[model samples]
Each structure stands twice: as C-alpha cells, then as structure tokens.
Target: MKPKLLTLSLVSAITPITLLAEDVTTLPTITVEGERLPEPGISREKPEDMVGTPADAGDFLRDIPGVSGTRMGGHGIDPIIRGQSQTQLNILLDGAYVHGGCPNRMDPPTAYSPVETYDSVTVIKGSQTVIYGGGGSGGTVLFERKTPRLTEDKFIRGQVGGGYTTNSGTKELFGDVTAGSTQGFARGIIEYRDADNYEDGSGNETRSAHTSQTGNLILGYTPNDKTRLELGLEANRTEDVLYSGAGMDSPQADNDTIRLKYENQWGTKADVYYSDVEHVMDNYSLRSLTAPMKMRVPSKSKTQGGRISHNLLMDNEMEWTMGFDYQHNNRDANRFAGPPNMPTPTMLQSIMWPDVDLTQIGMFGEMQMPVRDIHILKMGLRYDRVTSEANRAGQAAMGGVTPNRLYQQYYGKNADVVDENNIGGFI
Candidate 1:
C-alpha cells in the first residue's frame, strides 16, 4: 500500500465595518489563491546563487519547490520531497552514496553534505528516470561538484568565506582552493562550524548545539580535452551534538569517503565509491544524569557502490541510456548500560543492529524520442535484485536473548535471510 499525506490551513482576517447613511450599491468580489503548481522535470541551481547561508544540504533544499525538512538539532535536518522520505528518496553526493550510522536518523545523508562546497544541487521530482537506481518513488537529490578547467592565464581559482548567526551564536568558516595547468588540477576544501543552543522567538531555550568540521580533496587528470579522470577523498567529523527532540546526545559522529570517476566526450561514464560512518550517542555525556542507569549506543555503517552508463544518440534524434549499478550496505550497533557515573559501560543492554547487510544490483534502459513538433515521448525499464541478511541474528545479547528470538516474540516471524526481485517501468 502507498502512503498518503493531507494538509490543511485556516486564515482569518478581521476588518472593521463602517456604517454610512447611504445604502450600499455594489460589493467587490473576493478571490482566494493557493500555492502554485509544481513544475515537472529537473531543477538545478548553483549553490552560490542561493539566498542566505545554508548549514547543510537540507537547508539548501528548502528553497526548492515541493521540498521540506525536519530539524533534528542545530545540524542534520532530514529532507522530505513531495511527501516521500528516507529510503524512498535517492540522495547522492557527487555520484556516491553515504548512509548515516544513527539508527534513529540523527544524521541523514544530507547532514554530511556541505552546501557551499559543491557547485550545484539538482532535484528530480517524482520517478523521472531509472538510471540513478531503483525505488526512488518520491524523487532524487544530487549534490555535485564540477571539474576545474585551468589555463596558463588563470591557473588558480577558489573561494574563502565565513558567516555568523547572532541568535544561536553559530559561527562558520569555509575555504575552497584549486590549482593546476590544462593537463590536471588539484582541489581542496575545508569547513568548520560551531553553534550554541538557540532560543525561540518567545525566549525559550532549545537544547541544540553542535560542532562540525569537514575536509575534501580532489585530483583530476585531463589527458585530453575529451577525457577526464578524477579521484576524491572526504572526511567529516561532528562532536558534542545536543538534541532536544531525542533522548540521547551524540558525542561523536564521523564519516570518511573515497571515490573514483571517469568520463569521456563520447557520453560514457563510470563511478565507484566507498563510505564509512561511525556514530556514538549517550544520555550522560552531554546532558544531566537524570536516569538511574547510564545508557550509550555506538554504531557503524559501511557502503560500497558503483555505476557505469553510456548515452547514445540515434539518427532520428532519439536518445538512449543504459546502465548497471550495484550497492552493498553493512551496519552494526550495540547498546550498553551501567550504573550512573560509570565512565565505561561493559554490560550489553541490547543489540540495536545485529550486523545486517543489504545488497542491491540493478540494470536499467531508458529512451527519449521526439515524436513531432512540440511533442516528446520518454520511457524507461529497470530490474533489480536485492538480498538482505542479519549475520548475528542468533547471537545472544541482553539476558542471553537473541535478536532472532526477540523478532519471533514480537512479530511472530523467523529472522532469516531474504531476497527479492523487482521490475519497474515508466512511460
């Protein structure tokens, strides 16, 4: 079954009625207007052109139509597009995927993406294409950086800036630099942000504070004008993040990513990436020790993916794109509890994520043809194979109870490996 959403708003206007000696002759007609209809297809915009400074990709996406976000804390705002969120939406960072380590979604994909570091952000609403992957029923968001072109006249380019928000005492500093000749170029970026708890308009304080730092480097080799190869490395670290909406505060959340990409003038492209994330959250580290016992959870996630595609143009002005993509994700998390004021907790409270692994492989083909004057037709077909397994489902945890046993007790189902094959198409 598909999910649905409904929203309603009410507005009231009070106007004084004036009494006059003469009788009323005519009354003016009133018309009410609603929001404009969303436009179809893709929307791309330069990050520098965006109004105001955005803390992360989620803040940047709020400017786009049909996009909204849920604020978790001072940082990490989860984005929702066209009422679709989480796994239903495909979020990509320079053709790579980064999964958050927090099981409660304190750190979504967008949380790691620094808006100013990228050249452009693209949003494709709805199921517009199949080349990006499968199950993006809601939409897709791509944060992309462009390759730098250097010449003898202008061999260096970059930007450095900083901003501050008074209400929250939020401070940010960022820098981007690139240098090289026509054959190759090297780029580097660094960003740092620190924020304190903020107060609402009514002067109520919210427990939202965080500190984050990010570093990225890219080396591009352009042997010829038609061919380009690039390697990218990135790291993000967040510490002492406090959240008002969640039970625990994050002490450390870190991410590391590496990617390689190749493209040619012939419309051939290839990309491969690997990402790792580590997250730690505890109730005592950043907040008062109100509970009788100290609780903490540490989780880790890893993702590896690649894609290869080619575009072809026919004599009839029709375009065809075909591609294959594969992705594998692994996650493990554990919760621990001990007496209050205990620095290190050894007791195993629960197996939050019992070493789960998910893999998906997909192949897709799409065609766009010009039918006649002012008319066009597009179609696409995709097939995907998915496999999932919990390697430690039977491992004992918390009173010698296994995850599989808990699953059986709660849902009355066996925790066994599963596989699925899916086919999707659009016209």
Candidate 2:
C-alpha cells in the first residue's frame, strides 16, 4: 500500500453561476437563468425563456401557455399572441411601435429589433397594457434594457462574448462595457452578424441566411435612489437575397432602422416612457425572369412613429401601464420588364401596395391579481382612433396602382374608435 493517507486528490469543475446559485441564495426576486423568468405568478419557468436572439424571441413567447405566432425561415417568428397579427399586438421597442416597409412579411418587426441588445422582455399577454398604441391592438411586448442597480458606491463592470451557429456556419460578436458611479452611468455596444444561408438538419437549404449589423448607445442618471432617467439610441440593419419557391430569380433586399427612447420611474417603480422610431426599406425587389419572359418587381416603403407610456404601481398590486402612439406609411411600386412578361412588356401596376397612409392613437390599461401564489388573474381594455388618407393619386404620387387602403377598408366596415379587449389566466 502506497501510503493510503497520502494518496488524495480532489478536482472540481463548476461554473461560476452554477456555484453561485448553489450557495447563499434562498429567495431571488429576479432569477437570472439568463433572462428566463418564467410565468412567475402561478406560471412555472420553462426552457423557452432563455432563447435570446430576436429571431428566436417569438418562439419563446409562442410556447408560453395561451400564446402562438407564425413562423418563417425558421427564424423571425411573429407571434399571434392570442389570435392577433401585425397591428393587433403592440411589439414595442423602447415603448414605440416599430414598423418595417416589407409588406411580404420578409422582415418582420423583430427583424429591426436585434434581440441580443435588450436585458429583459415582458409580454402583456392580452390587452394587459394600455400604452402600446396601434401595434398593441393585438397585445404588447416590452423589450427593455436592464437598468443599473443603485449601489452604495461607485463600480465598473462589463461582459464580452461571441457565438457560432452550426446551421448557417456563421460567427457573431456582441457585448457591452458598463462604467458607473454613485450619480450616473454610461454604456455602448456594436454587434456585427453575418451568415451564409443555413441548411436544415436534412441538409436542405432554408433560404434564410442574412447579414445583420446593430449598434447601441445608452446613458443613465440616477441622482437619487427613487428617480431613474435613461436614454438609448439603437439601430438595426440587415441585407439578404430572397429566394421565393415560386420565383426562379432571387431578389436582394435591405432594411434600415433607428430608435430613440427616454424613460423615468417614480416611487416604487411606477414607469414612464417616451420613444420615437424611424424605419426605411431601400426596396422590395423580386425577379421577373420567368418561363414567360424577363421582368423585375420593384418597390419602396417607409414608416415613422412616436409613442409614450406611464405606469402606476397601485396598492392593489395591479401593475397598471398606459400609453399612446402613431404611425405613417409611404410606398411606391412598379413592375419593370427586362425578363419575362416582355412580350406585352407588362407595366408593373402600383395597385398591389398602393400609396396608403394611416395614423392611429389609442389608450389602454391592464392589471393583474395574484391568487395564492398559484393563480394569476389579468384583465385589460383598449380604445383606438385611426385617421386614414388615400391620395386621389396617392397611388400616382408613388407610381402605384389604385389605392388598396387595407386597414382603411376594414375601418370603413368597422369605423374608428375601435374597441379591443383580452383576458386570460395561468396557474
């Protein structure tokens, strides 16, 4: 026996967070399993909570009980959020409705919202929050940056990391540097994302790979413990080649987005926010070089909006949130023949997406009641006012065909001051 007492070796391989979670933590107000705080009120946590990217954010929300959204390219999943699309759910960025020019759903709202930038995402399942404006007509999603904690003294901290995707064989880099003092703080970040098209596990191309870039600047000042002020400017840009299953020729496309926001909270975290967003799509193009002839489908669209919200932390524990917003859309479209349809040399009409403009304002409110730490009762109300305009030649102004006036037509049948509501519970 080789000195039985001398032959002793101990090796430990434990992650920092794992070790932390194992010790000295009995009750955590907000568990950071990496942004996965499940339905806390009677709603246990789930795996979908941790999917971080914008492309995957909706998947998490959809998997939540009583929630679902449409899927495309295996990414940019747009949630139905209780049977609602587009304008129904108020998918907000810094509290403003962000609208992209792509009518084909190629680049959904989240496309302009690079998910990695936000610290936390809150989904108001139904008409739970009053401030989401037009998009929230369906529901409201709040993607917010983490506010710096009011520590006793000055401190400096930061995190940096990168990842690689097997599907697209793409590499991405993103992170942040945070420096602070007792009075205030500032942080900034730049992210570059690019990847060739990804092939599904079956080795079949998904036609969903694109290059994306985002940059954000954040500033904050907490003069005192009860008051916090925050300002942030963010941008998301992406480009890709669209390959339609029906069309042979591929069309290259691009989108540009900008968002600015200011937020402040009163006593006990009563939230107030004001934000503005601008989005521009260079052009939505598709190939016309088909069996019939050579052609080109080309168009351009732009949208801009502003929004505001105020929250009241009532004694009843009804986390009440309310707000308003407006949006404008401008479009121009045409079909140019260089390939197919050349025989008659068909002229792409502007009718498909006519020159349509709309402005919407709405008021909404929501409150939740916690029942025995096992049941959650939530209710909401919303009132919307819309103003629509179709230029006599709004179509001609943008070289479009006859006016489509989609929402306007719907409102024509339904009228302004639309009333919308939502109710649900999870235990």
Candidate 3:
C-alpha cells in the first residue's frame, strides 16, 4: 500500500474534483432536425452551472427530479428536495453540519455558507453509504471547500458581481482572490447584500425584505508531493425580516467559523489525515419588538470536531478507503412565554439551558470495482456510536415592582433528558 491518505466532512467524504457539466440529463447533438439552441437560454459562451447558497441553490438542482421550495422572503426559496427538510436530510458545510436557525422552513442550510467556497456540491438523494457516515435518512447535501493547490505562476485572481429583483429591487456583491506558489498559497472571499421589503406578485408588500454579509479565508501549504496542510475561516451575519417564523426576528447576528486541516501520504500508495472545525451562531434582540411586545429572545451555539482516514489501492481496477470520524454540536437558546394582556406591570423570567451535545465515533470502509471499461460498482459500510444530551440550566422570577422588563423568556422547563443512543448504517 502506498501512502495516499484522504479526508472529508464526517457526513460527506469529499474528494477533490473539477466541477464538470455532466449529469443524468442530456440531449442528442443531432437533435430532430439540425444542431440548434440547446434547451432555450443555455448559451455555449456560458457553460451551465449549478446554483447553491443565497437560497437559490435549488436552481442548480433542477437536473434532479421531484425537488421544490416554498417562497420565503428574498434570495431564493428554501430547497425542498423530494419533500424533506432538516431532520430527514443532512446538510454539510465544507462537508460538516452548520445547523440552521429556523425550524418552520426559512433559512435553509445552504444559506449558511457561500457557494463560491467549494468546487462542487455532492447531493446524495437517499441512504447511500455509511462510509460517508449516517443520519441522512432523507438524503445528504455536501457543501464542500475544494482541496488547495497552488499554481506555478504565484499570482492572485478574483471576480465580483451583483443583481436586482422586480419587487425588493435588491443589491448584492461577491468577490474572492487566490494567490500562492508551488510551496503554499492563501485565498479569501467576501459577500455583502441587502433588500427592502418586497411586494408579492399581486403588489402586496411583504415585510420579509432583509440584509446579510459573509466573508471567508483559506490558507494552504505543501511540504512534498504526497502530503498537504490547510486552514480556513468564515463569518456571516443577517438582520431582520417580517416573515419566517422563529418566534422573534433577528436584529443582530454573529456567526463565525474556523477550520484546520492536514493531509500526509506515506508513499504513492498510503495516506493519513487530520482535520478539525469550529462554528458559532449568535442572535440579538430587536428594538421594534422590545418597545411594543416587550419581548426578547437571544441564543448562541458552538460546534467543533475532528476526523482521520486512510486509503488503499487494491489493484488497477479496484480500490478501498477506510477511516474514522468524530463530531460534537452544542447550543444555548432562550425562549419567552409571558403576559395575558397585563399582570399589573409585573415581571417574570424563565431561563432554560437549551444546550445540547452530540458526539459520534465511527469506522468506515469503501470498495469500488470496475465491471467493465464503462461500467463499475461502488459500495461502503460503517458502524457509529452516537450520543446526545440536554440538561436544564435554571429558572428565576425577577421584578422591579413597575416592571422594568415588559416581557422576558426562559428555556428547558421540560426537564429535557439527554436523548442519547448508538447508531450505524449505510451512507
């Protein structure tokens, strides 16, 4: 076995790729009469590409069958892949979980990370392979960050663009730069966007217009021909919107992440890898709601994890990949339930430690065999030990006689026990 180790998100064993325009859908070049327009507006000057992130990622998924999304406010609608959301499916950032903010179908996972960060996004429509890890009963979406490789020129290049809508008449921008030599290189990207309240197709104004900002950076180094090392950072934030039910609208947001990854190959035939990621999300109260509703709901979360894997080439037409991965997700959120018109200007506070921790340890292996030059077979299997827990933080009643706080909320009154379990299955 030559050293050729590999890595990926515990949920989406991602490999390097060149994002090609090949899918299950295709039309004959000859056509019915002559070589003409290919399916309407798709021009040869501009190759067809998938659209992900910014909520409109589903447009890229059109090649897949039975997928749709309900209109939220702006950006695009949330992805509705074969009638499933969140739990039924698994969403990965650079291949890991970014866990969304809304539960009622607003703010999809792809919205957490920008699309330009990855070379490609792998969408598995079903329980495909345990080697990619489990939990994707509905399916899995891997928003990947490409493996780093510096060019010989040692130069930096980037691009920026923006667009507007008929209703909200929005403004947005995107740009990134990459530069390095054969030894090491680094890249970074930034995004800024905003929109005013938009009217429905019928001219009815919807208060859902909002604003968002995001930034990303990546660093890579190569010591030899077989192994490599890389690091990354990303930050995102969003303001308020009228719709998208999550009890309270966002006034301020702080979402930042950091990642460190290392890859080492023994020879051309063997490999080793180590990668870790940390993510954070925070929400602040809004002024409009505080004055009238006297309501406040703030929450924060942090998730960090690491993984390692090895690869083996059995022969020219057969290959095997094996590895183990571990991850943990935790959060602290505040929920408010108060007032029946008025309690004589009284104040009450209920706080629950909505914090939860999930950890998974697993070993997986994959085998691929080529039955023919054009036909091949692929399979993978794994076993995982996963556990989850939730503990009550506390609760208290506070008042200033005249009610300094119009209204306040708390969390975990249910004495929520940690939902812990061990699980394993196909990818």
Candidate 4:
C-alpha cells in the first residue's frame, strides 16, 4: 500500500509535466482592460505628425479647438487658449518652467519649445490640480517625453527627416537617435529651422525671418524590469526672431534645462528640474538703432522645481494618488535706450522687470473607486500657497512716475507684496 501511494503521487506530478511538455498549440490567453480618467476639459495632441505644418510652436495649436495665436510676424506667434495667453496660462516643458523674455510678448514660452522633439502635449483648461505648479488660472500645457523600455537584445534606433516650405523659404532638419541594451539606454535629438521673410497675399514682405535650434540628450538605467532612473539635458537657441507688430526684434534667446527622474512599479515617481533663459532684444540688432524709438531690453529668468508623487492601490478596486510640489522663479531686466537725437545712449537699467520673484507650494490628492461594473467615482482636493514680490519700487527712466507711486495712488500704500492661499476640490 505504501509503494502504491508513492507511485500514485509520482505519476500525478509527472502527468502535468508530460502534458505541458507535449503541448505545442495551446497557450494561456491574457486580456488587459483599461479605463480613462474622469477629469474633463483635457485635450491631448501628438506633435510628431505636425512636422508637416509650419515650424513655429504656435502652428501646432491651430488645429486644437478653442485655441488661437497672436501673429506678430511669420514666426514666434504667441498662443492664446480660450482668450488666455502669457503668464495666465501655465506652459511646462517636461515638468520644468521657463519665462518669456520680451515685454511686448514677442518671445513666448512656446517659442522656446521644439514641437518635433516632444511626444505628447496635454492641455488642461482652467484650474485643475495642484500636482503641478501654481497659477494655472487660464490653463496648463504639459510637454512630455515618454521613455521606451529596454529590450534584452542590444540595438539602435534612429529617425532623420527634413522639409522645406516655399512661402517663406523655410527649411527644417531633425534627427533622433537611441542606442541601448537590456540594462541601459541613451537617446539624443536635434531640431533646426531657418526661414526667410514671407510675403503677404499682396506680395508685401513681412518681418518674420527667424532661425532656431534645439538639442536634447537623455541617459537612462534600469536595474530591473519595473524600475527606471533617468537624467536629461537640453539647450535651445532662437536668433533673429522678428516681430513686425512689436517694437523690437529678438537678436538672441538662449535657454538651458536639466532634469532628473525616477520611477518604480510600486507606483512611486519623482522629478527634479531647473531651467535658465536669457534674452536680448534690441532695435539695433534687427532694425535701425538710429530710429526715433530705439530701445533694447535684456532679461534673464531662473526657475527650479520638483515634485514627488505616489499611487496607492486599494483592494484591487480603488486607487489613491497624492503628491507635493514646489516651484521658485526669479526674473531681472535692464533696458538700454538710444535715439537719433542723442549722441550717447542712456540706460533705464533698473526698471524693466524690477527684480520680480514668484514662489508657490502646493499639496494635492485624488481618489478613484469603482462603484459598479460600469460606474466609477472620482474625487480630488488641492491647496496652494503663493507669494509674489518685487524688489525695486521705482519706474524706468522713460516713465515720468514711479510704479510704487502709481500703485499707491490706485490701490493704497503697503501693497508691495501679494500673498494668497487657495483651496480647491472636485467630485
């Protein structure tokens, strides 16, 4: 009886093995189900297909509903979403911040971004979440890059393309390359565009000649299949950006960015980034300095921020996500002046930006639960603390009155700083 029991146990174990070994056509099937978030008023675009459109960043927004742009020339058009533009709308490049340099809105944040280099552009209308930085009253545009998984086989991938437009003699050249093994990967991208002035329908030449170039490099490491760490560097330059409707042309605009990110299958993610932008726009560089209203304004902006977020899965039926984010920005400006009557130029150096500083900190959380087979419940809450201040109280040399005096006359005294606390939620 003992021998028979041992034989029966061995046969049972070996029977399944023999069945699996003989199986050649039968295999297990896998089905994956997905659900969309309940958030509304969100729009997304894939910019790679937009290469056929104009080379400017504003060109991509033309197809999106409820979005428009202010055309100053043939290039560097500022985007307006639902009648909101400039600082009113938050523009982020890979979760980083950059400020425009032109006071007349000549060089918007979009101008600094290379549309071809990004994979996704997400637009959220109105105040949505505090996971990102604050002051997104009008909306938010997030430019994102997705990293590909490393394969077991070592290989390289790349794309090269170019295009030309006859209307303005515009030319664009772009290339993307990636090389990797199962453990690590590296990628690089470059996009360059140059265009001459384009003629209106009436055959009149417009002041829109421009040249721009951007480069980005990323290095990533994967210790396991479920975790990834990455570092990214980017540099962008735009030269000869002409604005016909505005008073000055941007001779040189330079931007630098650095980013670090980490993610794991445990639903934890983090990002740290910094960006710096310097802009030099003068009438003399692109137009005549001897003109009656010759002016030059050079400005620099520095921004740094970071965010850490986690996803908590509860009982396989619900998900909760919470995060904290903070951002700081500093801006300084100095203006140079000259005219046909003056032999020497005088600088209104201290007054352009007045050394502005903006700081914001926020905490946010969201929860999603499956109420039934076909229904879901979603809720979110966020709180933000924002502060804005200016160091200089005086006005430019060209102005007859000071900014502090004007503010005091209108609002009252001791209005030098603004502090605000906001709490928002949705269900």
Q: Judging by lDDT against the true structure, name the best candidate.
A: 1
- In candidate 2, clashing pairs total 24
lDDT at position 13, candidate 3: 43
Candidate 4 Cα errors over 4 Å, as ranges: 1-40, 289-293, 341-346, 371-376, 394-401, 409-415
Candidate 2 lDDT by residue in tens digits, 1-427: 5565345321133456677877884765875557544553222223224544334456556656667777555445577766877767767665544555445555456665655666766776654445455345456777667656546564677766666777676767777777787677787867777766677678877665556677777777877665666666666666554333324222333444455545555422323332222222222233233244444444555666665666677777767665555555565444444343234335543344444456555565666777676676766666666666544333431353334344456555422332334333222
User: All candidates: CA RMSD in angstroms?
Assistant: 14.8, 13.0, 17.1, 11.0
Q: lDDT tens string, model 4, 1-427?
A: 9999999999999999999889778668989899776446788888876647565667687667777888787666778878888887888888787777666666677887878888898888876654566566678888888767667664678888888989989999999898988788899999999999889999998888899999999999977777989899999998888878877788888999999999899999999999898998777768766566557788888888888999999987789889998888888777777775664456573366778888888898988898867676877788889999987666535556555676678889733788989887767
Question: Which residue ranges in model 3 land beyond 4 Å of their true spot?
Answer: 1-64, 70-72, 75-78, 101-108, 224-226, 244-247, 265-293, 337-353, 393-423
* Candidate order (lDDT): 1, 4, 3, 2
Q: Whole-model lDDT, candidate 1? A: 0.90
TM-score between candidate 1 and the true structure: 0.89
Model 2 segments beyond 4 Å from truth? 1-56, 59-75, 134-138, 150-154, 244-288, 291-348, 365-379, 392-401, 404-427
Give the CA lDDT, 0 to 100, for residue 158 in model 2. Answer: 70
Give the local distance difference test score of model 3: 0.55
Question: What C-alpha lDDT do the candidate models reach, one value each?
Answer: 0.90, 0.55, 0.55, 0.80
TM-score of 2: 0.67
Error of 2 at 287 (Å): 7.8
Per-residue error for 399 in candidate 4, Å, reads: 7.7
TM-score of each: 0.89, 0.67, 0.71, 0.84
